[model samples]
Target: MELTLAQEKALNALVYFAERIKPLYLTKAIKLLYMADEQAIRDTGVPITWLDYKAWRFGPVPEDVYNKVKQVDNLQKLDAGDGVLYSLKVSDAPADLPEGLVLNPIRPFNDDEFSDYEIEILQKVIDRYGKLTSEQLVDILHQEGTLWHRVVQANNLKQQFELKSNRSDYIIEFTDLLDTDYKKAAFEVAYQSHLMQQNLM
Candidate 1:
């Protein structure tokens, strides 16, 4: 399948982080992107990217994004100095080679591509988690009662054999991350926006 909207947003989020958090390790980068989506899902009652997260040892990883980045690793290693993808010299990904996509200095993304809500979410997550290392972030994700925790602890057959989790499935109005107050506000905002759009239609 072609890149989904969330996938494109995931890439855009990466570009945003790379611009600010220069010399970002792919490991930290991926985790940051995941957190951005999680934070937005919590705040807005919707996810920035509807990624199918696999509960990897570090945290929840987008399996497709991981594979794609891994496939690009060889090219980054060989052509890091000159490759367009690694024009900034995506350094060695800290996580096992190929998985941590070390991003080089790349151009900042165009602002036009992101929604106002997306921009706000990305900035908020970065501001909150910017200084955190991958290990620290992993610990946060590993906390009890987290989506990562429940899915991993359960260890269903799908998880045991194929590492699948429907927990990460995307559905509006279904995020467990958001607090009740936040959910209420989000629901109100969404309802208002829906009504406005309907009026226009």
Candidate 2:
């Protein structure tokens, strides 16, 4: 597919960053792509997605386009989770990691404010669904035009389970760490920071 000017710019930026800072987390790489796309949209008023760039703009890229981009750029993939239960190699690393695996520090969002209505919505989802996937939560919030807010809330939901599947059956259970108010707060802060940084960029 033809590359939009915005898509080209975002891909180029992603490649540039990938080369400079080999990330350990695919989500971080995806986040970088999203950030670049967000920035491109902010600058040029064009919207793009990883799927769009991979299938349309970049032209016949690999199924794992983000990972392929990292490989082509000579960046190493490291242990990371896909925010779901399964373990997957991530392409970005936190700044504090060992040498030769340096990654750009993720910027924290300045705004930590959440409206009462937002919190209420989150409580409602937790009350209704108990534990839910991020994608599922996103679908629910999309209807209300508050997908972003729910993304923040899902991140804030303290209880996390590592999903396991066997024979095409799936089970959701708690992770090793017990849920606590502190963890929930940290998740909220991180989620908000991620959202704000992406939106800002």
Candidate 3:
């Protein structure tokens, strides 16, 4: 949540401008502020995404100010290869955020929150599919009766498609589901049930 000096300056400028400008012109005002503080703005190196010269007319900011005010606005338009951009509004700023600076306000996936089964399944899917979309993998798993079964199947598919296809000696890599944690508590119940059926054996 620590903010760089440039972030602090930019945020303060935003706050100052927000107080005096008509609600419709806040976006334009921010851009102008950035222009006035060109060096500070440039230091951010975040590309402008949306240029709403008229957002303030609505009065009271939208809940998704960070997203609406992003240097890059339409996230869907960004190339997938581009690194993920983090964003946050002043209200959403973390307490630990430095004075004058706001956290970009993005959330990160917690790896520790994942269950062993989910990890195993996800890893298998990635290895096999190389880069299948999350939706595609989810659909495939849904068809397998149990979620774990779907994960196992997706994993199996990846192994068959990647390893087995490339090397005649390749064997399916089995996961010890009993020893692993699930990303969600629900996964544990499902995993244990699957194990009881000797499916994991």
Local distance difference test values of all predictions, in order: 0.66, 0.33, 0.32
Q: 37-57, model 2: which lDDT tens digit per residue? A: 333333333223323322111
Candidate 1, residues 1-201: lDDT per residue as tens digits? 234445555666777887887557777878888888777677676666666677766677887766655555565555535323443335455664444456654655656657898888888888998888878888998888878777666754235435643344322223556668867677567656645744663
lDDT per residue, candidate 3, 53-168, as tens digits? 11121111222333434533344244353322332233323465322223233433233423444334333423454343323433443344432343335445445535444212
The residue pairs in collision within model 1 are: 88-104, 88-105
**Best-performing candidate as measured by TM-score:** 1
Ranking by TM-score: 1, 2, 3
For model 2, give the RMSD to the true fold: 17.4
> Worst 10-residue stretch by lDDT in candidate 3?
51-60
Cα distance off (Å), candidate 1, residue 15: 0.8
RMSD of each: 6.8, 17.4, 23.0
Q: TM-score, each model?
A: 0.67, 0.27, 0.21
For candidate 1, the 10 contiguous residues with the lowest summed lDDT are 165-174
